[model samples]
Target: RLAGSAAGWGFQFQSPGFVVAVCWLLFLMGLNLLGVFEVSAGRLGQVQTGSGRGGDMMTGLLAVIVATPCTAPFMGVAIAGALGGSPVMGVLVFLSMGLGLAFPYILVAGVPGVASRMPKPGAWMGILKQVLAFPLFATCVWLLWVAAIQRGVTFVALTAGGVVLLGFAGWIYGVGQRRSMLEGGRGTVAFCRVVAALCVVICGAALAQGLRAAPAPVVAGAVEAGVEPFSEARLAELRAQGKPVFIDMTASWCITCMVNERVALDVPSVQEAFRSRGIVFLKGDWTNRNAAIAEFLKAHGRDGVPFYMYYAPHQDGVVLPQILTPGIVISTIGK
Candidate 1:
């Protein structure tokens, strides 16, 4: 869906942090398979339990989200083509990508013989569970890196610490579970469920708040002090004045876009080149998913962002590459 929208609507594809998160997840899963960590059968052992179901569902969701950051080589061309086509066409392309991702999991889970051949619940399971925690730890590290890019190291540390504490609490709870607790009365089980739900809700809220409080990243070398974002009307007016305009359409969730701005766009030479060429720089914020921006993307055949469009005086508009380079920008403007 994202790739299709990006191509059709000219949105940029920026997802390095996502890529790291996915790689870490795969690494952790691999470690579990290799018997690096053990899974435990405890009071919360029943796969049918609400908590177990919730955990499994959450894991599945995280897998999907993490996988989205890195486009496999085979998927790149299809995604690019979707972004440059009609909305329906773009959506179809995304659907194909989704199917490709889900197929392996479905096959593994559906085949009864294959599922039975998998390691039975045992001591190794406990070790596998502990090893799985390492991936979550790695994920925290990656999130911290991304947070450091936007906010400071302090905020990153705080967020990472909080996430670690949450994990530690979960580990303690899991390890403390006794067989007696599993055989306890219905009332006792109900109470435990309530407590677990409350804890999960609290942890979720804290994480959301931490992410919200993180500061916006500053585009390096750009004098952002009082430069207001450009409206569509303002862009049209500038075009009327025969000035070249560079539009950066981005969102807070876009890690790749942020990196591009800080590392490439913010370079002194890039900034100077834009200024010297009398280029009007405009930033279109898509943090909250504005309807106008959505329409803008749909017009270009996109459904999501990190989109970049360049309009030059007396020339055809140019769609910038998804992966940015200083030379790409300089050359585009120079033309």
Candidate 2:
């Protein structure tokens, strides 16, 4: 669905993005931990709870949102193609994608024997729910690392502090809920509400402060050594002059981008090719949002960072594969 609306669909994929997604997932998990889901589902969280279809839909939605959809193999091409076409086509494509993803759940729902064979609800379900939260927390840690790279140490510390504050608030809310449940006092519930409010306020203020302090300009030089900042104007000028150019749209957070840089693009032969052929290496850092690169990606049937294209003299841009080889670069651009 995101790709279907790709023209104006822009996401920074930054710390704030990570925090919002993670926070929501944590909130849902908190509810699950506190037995909100179980109670609502009549203790088993089973399909017979009257929201079977809704639960399946939510699962599909969460899969799309929590996981970066474009990173999957062939997903970029499918979404990119969908986005480039008419709106109706795009929507159909997205719907098809959703249906394909949800097929497994549909199968289980349709087959009673399959559902019956599933693990019985027991005390272990609670343990499994808690264990699942760890991956989300680990994701928070990864986002903080990327944030440090984009901003600085202070920014990272502030973001970390915000996480700590959120955890403290959750703890307070948990305690408050416990007291309210056991004692059934209006005072306890009121105190819990107050703490939740404070948590929201403190977290917002901390994030705002971090943003204000982070004036670090997104620089191409910061992307990698000897790579020029990408601009459409510069690229056009070079292409008009019949000069060869290589474009790298990447983000620090993209592991594929880093791996490609280290293994293929930054190798001696690849670097030497640029020096010999005068391949103007321009990098668009999508660590932060840039509308130009976003559009460019869409134009080339690509939806995200780590997209590579080579514009040869007197020729249109040749879109390179996501995974680059030293020989691929040397032969394609070196010649």
Q: Which predicted model would earn the best lDDT?
A: 2
Cα lDDT tens digits, model 1, 235-307, are: 8788898988888876654556677788768899889998798888888765443566667766664555566
Question: Residue pairs in steric clash, candidate 2?
Answer: none
Error of 1 at 167 (Å): 3.8
lDDT of 1 at 133: 62
With candidate 2 superimposed using the best TM-score fit, by how many Å does residue 313's alpha carbon deviate from the native? Answer: 4.5
TM-score each candidate: 0.58, 0.74
Off by over 4 Å in 2: 1-59, 69-73, 113-127, 149-154, 180-186, 205-214, 217-221, 236-244, 253-255, 266-278, 323-331
RMSD of each: 8.2, 5.0
